[model samples]
Target chain A: MEIVRPTLLLDKETCLRNIARMAEKAKAKNLDFCPHFKTHQSAIIGEWFREFGISAITVSSVQMAQYFARNGWTDITIALPVNILEIDQINQLASGINLNLLVENKESLVFLDKFIKFQAGIYIEIDTGYNRTGVAAHKTNLVDGLLEIVKNNKLLDFKGFLSHTGHTYQASSRHDIFNHHFDALLKMRSLKNRYKKDWPNLKLSLGDTPSASICDNFDGIDELRPGNFIFYDLMQYKLGTCKFEDIALRLVCPVIARHASRNEVIIYGGAIHTSKDSIINIDGKELYGQVIINQNGQKILLDERNYLHKLSQEHGIIKVTYKDFNSFKVGDLVEIVPVHSCLTANLMGSYLTSDGEYIPTIRQA
Target chain B: MEIVRPTLLLDKETCLRNIARMAEKAKAKNLDFCPHFKTHQSAIIGEWFREFGISAITVSSVQMAQYFARNGWTDITIALPVNILEIDQINQLASGINLNLLVENKESLVFLDKFIKFQAGIYIEIDTGYNRTGVAAHKTNLVDGLLEIVKNNKLLDFKGFLSHTGHTYQASSRHDIFNHHFDALLKMRSLKNRYKKDWPNLKLSLGDTPSASICDNFDGIDELRPGNFIFYDLMQYKLGTCKFEDIALRLVCPVIARHASRNEVIIYGGAIHTSKDSIINIDGKELYGQVIINQNGQKILLDERNYLHKLSQEHGIIKVTYKDFNSFKVGDLVEIVPVHSCLTANLMGSYLTSDGEYIPTIRQA
Candidate 1:
């Protein structure tokens, strides 16, 4: 059961616990949970959600939706704004599953009308001040035009409204994120009230990792979709979303070489495993990630004075300030907590469970 | 066979031409070409090198070596310092292929001695001022200790000295990169001379994308191991490594939605496709990449005044200028040349060939 160092180690227990916690929160709030699958795109991982009585999911692309759809996910909301160029795939997906699409403009609705045959729920994404995606909430005419096109079409169905407050991730504190989420929900509620007389059964959905993790109140929300909670990373820690112990994934790396003069220790893990994602450490120092306890399970931070400053394709350079870098001799296995687990997991390709179990990751093209 | 937008498109012809060009360069210089597989990481792509008469190949990991080994690549040099924790896999790999290991110190040589049974070629990695990995060239004692360990271990064969002038990538111009490469070569030559009496058969190996792309001289080096030339990217263009047209990979994305007031467009492509890698534009503007003419293959500067400014997991926000905002409607497809092709290709799991062909990428993990 000797797994290779610099490999991804997934704790199944923590993973299940994370999923259950999110599911429980959604259940308690009476909100439909459509967890974003982009965080962990494994079908095996999706099956774990099925165990929680979850039938619906969210994916980033049509290819990802098709992946989950083939694996028995019945209802899938393509969280991204529906690109009309892939309307053919949307038609195929809708014919099979309850495929809900997101659109921010009337132009997409007009394009979707050309290809869609079955009634598909369309979620109009509103940009509630997050300058990323979605149409501005005040753009009522755009919504009206979209609704008119949907009403005219035989296959299109106007579901409601959706928005992702992605800017919350950049929030400096919990209060900032909570306020952002609350304000976003208020905007969505106002949009819903504006169209409630016309469309009484309209659904209001909002999703974002920062808002979903910190905000406890979802009083007016209809559905919740957050992905990164499955494997909280260093960013989540910085955002006060999760504690360091809650991180479910770690890169197991081995000390390959050490330089005495520079007090730098080279490890097998590099940008490929830990990714280029970095954050300022506790000492206000920039570091790729904290060096966790090695095989001994002693979470030893390799001298705070030293930092993993640079990474090559396959080698990590840990600049140590301590004179005795020899403590971590060649062949010693070490674990690195990646700055971003989603990107790291995606880059690493597969994972080995804590119990020496190997889980091959499904490729998302 | 209309392919999905926001997909990586590869020109097989261009790839073959690039491979042939590198191979011809090595042949003319009488240098052994062990092209690093970290760039392509594809067996099919490696086959093109074999077609061009390349027998030796370089990989970043033992796992990668195993991947290429399975695909009939025999002479493989694992470019990173050997992690003894993966000795079992290395032993298994050595049994099947002509495996060579990289080491910077005697500690790694001592650690590797216990597991290797057959004589494995060990390449001493010298740091020619890169300060990333490898032992400093001035450290003759470290090299002596490494040689002593090789002399004591019957199973280990001292192959040569290797150095990756990785700092060349950070060079300001072609002249800077050329000087960096030249200085690294001179350092390697001095080290070779220092060990000439002890190891007369020692080979000199040098590699780096910037060095290979910018420097025409490979005079003193025994082998070349550049990888990024197979698929150039935005960083390469900025480094003066390749032209805009020479870039072999592009993310073909579909315009999903548009915002009129802000004059912004949302595309299906995001950080997952093009990566979070960004570069400063000509006007000291920071941008992820330039949008290309969708069908015409023309480079569209994306109205530099308004370019792809931000990216979420699966959503790319293109801030459009007020003037050209109305010209781009939903359903339009756009192509984006990525900032870092290696990371983009790794993220993009597969590629859509130029002739409407779908090619699934081989997973190296």
Candidate 2:
């Protein structure tokens, strides 16, 4: 692709390999591999997973479900807690497909039952340790109360228990990820064992890229919904979840100016292009992103010694040793591995594929 | 406006007041009031500045300059350095109107001279202390070389020196902001003074919200281009650049779930909507944003004691005291004073005015 201001470059080969790896893992475990489409957010990219016979998918919002549903995704689970205000959208999205909504309380279930005209699958979101959302797994009374309301409503189908181990992103080591994944699996299994007698076909779901990529003990988890594996970022790399070769996306920005005195090269990418998500550096500064040099269309990740250290609104300052900094002049294309790929992809609404094809994502208003 | 998800709400009254305030400041200082339109990247919001008798404006990208130019803006200076890859678009933009391009190196100037067809004004960007981009103010030989080349070129219109003191954002006290502003003013003045004998009507420009809002000295700075004053956010509020009442934009999001045990409320807004820019709270945790209850159509800023404490990809956890938490019910709208308004505005891409009108921003594939 031509080097412009800032282009999000996607390597289709790497993305396909990533998709295949996760799909094969789920198949090996005899689990439902419902990859979360929120990471790629592209119907074209989603089709790459269809080659693996994956039909059901997971999204974070109702609008996303509608987007993918219109694009021929028949079954979509909105993994976020139900926003009662979006009942109209939820009903509209559920009108033609098997739409799933997560609920932790009876208020949302009652609101869905009263407003939604079409059949909507409901899942009681269990807090398996993330603590960001979802009901505590030990809160059996609350879970039963929500389940009771969901069961009483003819329009609502009680799907199962769903939980997301998001805290794995903060894990310091692979052991931490496995421990979090283990605890989540134990709580979800215990909850499923308690309620399986009442509802025979309820499915247990766990989704998170870090745990899903490293852990193999998926014995009872019915469905797996790991996104980000398709385009693992620096955060995943730091968490020891994915290797650098599996990263499918890189932000190609133009070198605007060079500060040879400071050994810094500034680019046209910043917090807007790569959202202010960052990991702590060894020097205690926020590592906005890392610099990579592309040779013959292959991205070569640089050493951690040189990285995009500081960012303003529309400017990124990369601190490099003179040898690394001397390799580029102004107006040359500089590739950066964003701190978080999902946010970077979101900021860049479209992508230029490796074959020089521009593909629009599902972020347009 | 009905906010089913995270909605960017714009208050026209306060925004106009802010525009008037900065314009009046520039008028009082005998400086050109060329405000930066990068913060509120909306043509409708741009029209608000026209009411203050402002014509020439500054944008951060060529796409944004083209956007405003297509909507009848005649003069726009792209504050970013010229990217050689966008030479075609720059030529197209420069053909119809008086376009300004920033250049700091000889390579970009040579490319523009060879490729650009229309006359484009050039400003040599000087670095005061930000170290993000631009040539150092002390590099007189480099500046003189660039001037010699520009003088030899017919298509390049040489404007004066321009520098932005971005370090003002990191200032601990008002005294630090004053000192940073003072240093930038001195460096830019010395550069302009060195070249003023050659070019009689050279214009010196400086832009940044924190320093511009606090500093009264504009001895040699000929133009002011402050942007964030239009929608001052938590960062500016913390830096004493703007009052909370002057903050015109707020992200109105729905409360999807409430965790009473943790005294936390989960909102549908996340890093995708807020951009993950944060500040430190009193208790030493990162505060992504502060919660403000919308009293009728007006936003009332709450105490900093209760704020958004944690964030995930699609969820924001607001740590609230029970009293503040109980005031908000699930599905109730909560306005967030984001840590940085510029990034938040870019993410939302549109706004719902307080007068109940929807305004679409200039962001599309």
Candidate 3:
């Protein structure tokens, strides 16, 4: 609470605005807004979504689903392809709540069919350009195989096709994001058209912050589950998805040392606090994070040259410009805009709200 | 204990051997072995060093110092530049134990001189080429000013010059590592020679796993404080510091999906478990970790092409060769040799020993 070490400061106002904007976008499009809880991972923040008429939630793992289910969230979906090894825990969660699981292959479906004792919704994970996971959208045969097993099991309920357009994160421009999202939409729509006769009530779910924030075409998307929008970071800003002011988190670290000869400032934050997530700057060097000096009630964002350059276990070296080197001193509290807020939030395990209240996340809970 | 999720498996026999080897190296050279505990921030692992006559320990932060001190480690050195903001905790630790803090500038010494209530040893951090922190070794005037403040304070005991040649991690070859270590040695020795007359007993401390593992030069060095040698990783292997067998830790993750079209295997282990630390492989691609499949009572290290290629929040995409693709199946547990063990260990918070014992790290403790 005293801010002696590197602490993540969460601006409650910015986060509430982010949540409201995303919820409004989903409402206008008539889409079920099942925002992913993987970013914030806090039950308190999840409770804030209830005021916007949001009930359903999405998580990346079964452990997260159980955590939210215990907190009174009934409708939950585990977004990752189901790890069959965790079927026991999945079965336990399904027995209590309306749980949905993602399956990309028949192996996981067969395992679920044989082991699950309670009713669980199954969403076929379709790969639409994002080759991270999921079945290829064109591969209807694999989809038919997975559905056949689900149809035979009375405890399994067929939901719909789910896809994560993660490749939008690599978009070089707004045009690139639009093009990738359109291509993915076509692929997902083709599958929906082919299976509409058998599954008339099926839903299509798509997620990823880039396309969800920038692209306006949610032609066939039934639900939106963009997680990082809750705390848009430098990566989202670089991808043209969010503005700098939308970033709701900043790592507050104390400047421990200042080296004028080399024009560097050392801070207590490092790779352990902010994971080694970086972006290539204009100078073709790895920029870990942007620095901001809040002095005299004014927040001054340092120039491009004064960024977090190197990180060790507990030491972050910021390459300060000659013009800004004298502005820092020992024990000065500096703020670093993290490149990826999700990883930083995961590492810090908890957050200090703008009003100084402690918000405990899943890691602590 | 069931290990259904991504769990770090520690081979205790390998860790014990690593501890003995580094302790023997320090003994053979008559150097005081104060091994760095930042790599394995475990009180259980700290107890392992006691069997090898390692009484003094080195840590990276005041919190780690307190954690070890609570675990009965009397003598400890926080190897990072002193964060004057934590003067209260520093004073508390110094009052109870033999604590030493690293200082690079005069401001922190002045802070310590004014507020420290108990005797605390001081190490003047000298920059020998690692431009991350510390004063330049040749800057005698800066060193004089820092010592002047320490000499005037009765509670501060001047230990000596300490150098962390961390630049050796970027060495092109073992010869380059030797050159960097030798250059750092000359600079530290120069400072010691100039100050030996004023302070009769000043010990030169040096650390860095690359130099401690490969370079056979310990002339004029009194203490060795390398940490990562306790659990050698893929980065150390690439640096020619240790063999694959010496890597004691592995993230054992369950295989969730296998895509034959992309020749990729998606595992439950990901950036959250492995910490996105990578090295460029021979094919000019990022290699996150090496894949090792332990099936049918045999461990097989896949080829370079089958390395863990991509990482998401909770998913790892391992690009497998055609020959190695068929060997994997859904629900099979595979091991990933992490890129940087320290970050991985810190992220995991706990470890599962090969003998099925649970070991809690500092983050857990």
Judging by DockQ against the true structure, name the best candidate: 3
| Top-scoring candidate (lDDT) | 3
Give lDDT tens digits, candidate 2, residues B1-365: 56788898888899999988889999999999889999989898899898899999999998899899988899999999888889889999999999989998888888887888999899999989987777899999989889988898899889898888988999998899999999999999999889999998889999999988889999988999989999998888888888878888888889888888988888999988886778888998889888898666775667777898887767888888877777667888898888888888898888888899878778741
The alpha-carbon deviation from the true structure for residue B295 of candidate 2, after best TM-score superposition, in angstroms, is: 6.6
Better of 2 and 3 by lDDT: 3
Compose the digit string of candidate 3's lDDT tens values, residues B1-365: 68899999999999999989999999999999999999989999899999999899999999999999999999999999999999999999999999999999888888889999999999999999988889898889999999999999899999998989999988888888999999999998888889999998999999999999988889889999999999999999998999889999999999999999889999998888898989998789999999999769899988798999899999999999888899999999999999999999999999999899999998776
RMSD to the true structure for each prediction, in A, is 2.5, 1.7, 1.1
Real contacts recovered, all predictions: 0.75, 0.81, 0.85
CA-based DockQ, model 3? 0.86
Candidate 3's residue-wise lDDT over A5-49, tens digit each?
A: 999999999999999999999999999999999999999999989
Model 1 chain B, poorest ten-residue lDDT window?
Answer: B294-303
Q: B-chain TM-score, every candidate?
A: 0.94, 0.97, 0.99
- Cα lDDT tens digits, model 2, A116-140, are 8999898899998888888899999
TM-scores across all candidates?
0.94, 0.97, 0.99
Instruction: Give the 10-residue window scoring lowest on summed lDDT in candidate 3 chain A.
Output: A105-114
Off by over 4 Å in 2: A294-299, B294-300
- In candidate 2, the residue pairs with backbone N, CA or C atoms under 3 Å apart (3 or more residues apart, or in different chains) clash, namely none
What's the true lDDT of residue B49 in model 3? Answer: 93
Candidate 1: tens digits of C-alpha lDDT, residues B1-365 = 67556778898888877777878888888999889988877887777787888899998888788888988998999998887778888898888778999988776777787768776899999999788778888888988888888988888889999999988878889998989888888889998888888888999999788877667877778999999999888888889888777788888888877776667778888766777767886667667877765435555656466667777667888877787786566777777878888878777767777777666555633
